[model samples]
Target: MIKLYGMTGSGNCWKPAVLMKQLGQPFEWTEINTLKGETRTPEFLALNANGRVPLLIVNGRKLAESNAMLCYLADGTDYFPADRWQRAKILEWMFFEQYSHEPYIATVRFWVHFMQKQEEWKDKIAEAMKKGHAALGVMEQQLQKTSFLAGARYSIADIALYAYTHVAHEGGYDLNAYPAINDWMKRLEAQPKFEKMTG
Candidate 1:
């Protein structure tokens, strides 16, 4: 069986979990408390040089990075488009999720919710909220016309973005303002075998 080392509440960690569940793939989960310095331990670092959770161990080979793991698992699956243009578009959104979305949205969530440093990190949190909303605005514009990020079909791109976006409220970004994004999220949730970020 595949082994996934991750923290349950982490959106990055939640990415592959949701995808695997939707794909009906069985895997074992080993929770890693990153805040407790578990990821920095020699044992964990031996598995992941970056000392990050959401590591995938398959057949004794380790794979780190959440979006990369999603691509590996979704390859040749329905969630991964076969068409060249469609696949490229999916990759585009996935890249945007990492470069544009997660940096602000996920970071704010880590600070405000997980670290409970909303008061301490007030300035940083406020700045992150601005950038996070900008990212959501970009998403809202795309979702206004298409049902999914990678065009008309549901794909890994949606999964990548949804991982953090669905929980953006935890980061103090309001969802009610993005109607298109809201509806698109509903569409994703209605997909077969869908599961929430946390257990």
Candidate 2:
């Protein structure tokens, strides 16, 4: 059986869980509360020295990083195309998500929603939102052209970005400006077996 360690409501953790469910892959979930310092425990560190959630353990082999889990679970499936150029295109968005998108959007959401630092970190949050909007603009430009982030097909690239973009409002982002993104999100939600993230 595949056992996954993750925190509830976290976009990063939600990524693999949603993919596994859509792919009909059965897995066990073990919740680790990062806010409570659960990830710092020695036992958890043994599984992943980085001490992060969304750790996947299959057949006693452990894997860290949420995107890596997506790639591994989606392998040999349409979610990860067989075509070399298509695969590269999908990876391009995934990499952009991690570096350009998530760092700003996801982090701001974490600070505002989870930490409740909206008032305390107003200036910092404002600065981050600038970058977050820039990231969103970049996505808007691409999504305006393609039905999905990677291309016409729904792939893990969409899954990666959707995890955070859908809930960006909790971080003070106003998605009303991006009509294409709103439409794209609706399309993703309509996907078969799609489930919203839970806290």
Model 1 global lDDT (CA atoms, 0 to 1): 0.91
Instruction: For residues 1-199, write the lDDT of model 1, one tens digit per residue.
Output: 9999999889899999999998989999999999999999999999999999899999999999998999999999979968898888889888999999999999998888888999998998998889889999999999988988888889999889999998888878889989999899899999999887873
Which is the leading candidate under TM-score? Answer: 2
The worst-scoring run of ten residues by lDDT in candidate 2 lies at: 190-199
RMSD in Å for all candidates: 1.0, 0.6
TM-score for each model: 0.97, 0.99
Mind giving the per-residue lDDT tens digits that candidate 2 earns over 47-147?
Answer: 89999988999999999999989999999999998899999998998899999989899999999999999999999999999999999999999989999
Clashes of each: 0, 0
In angstroms, the error of model 2 at 58 is 0.8
Model 1, runs deviating above 4 Å:
none
Question: What is the number of residue pairs that collide in model 2?
Answer: 0
**Which numbered prediction scores highest in lDDT against the true structure?**
2
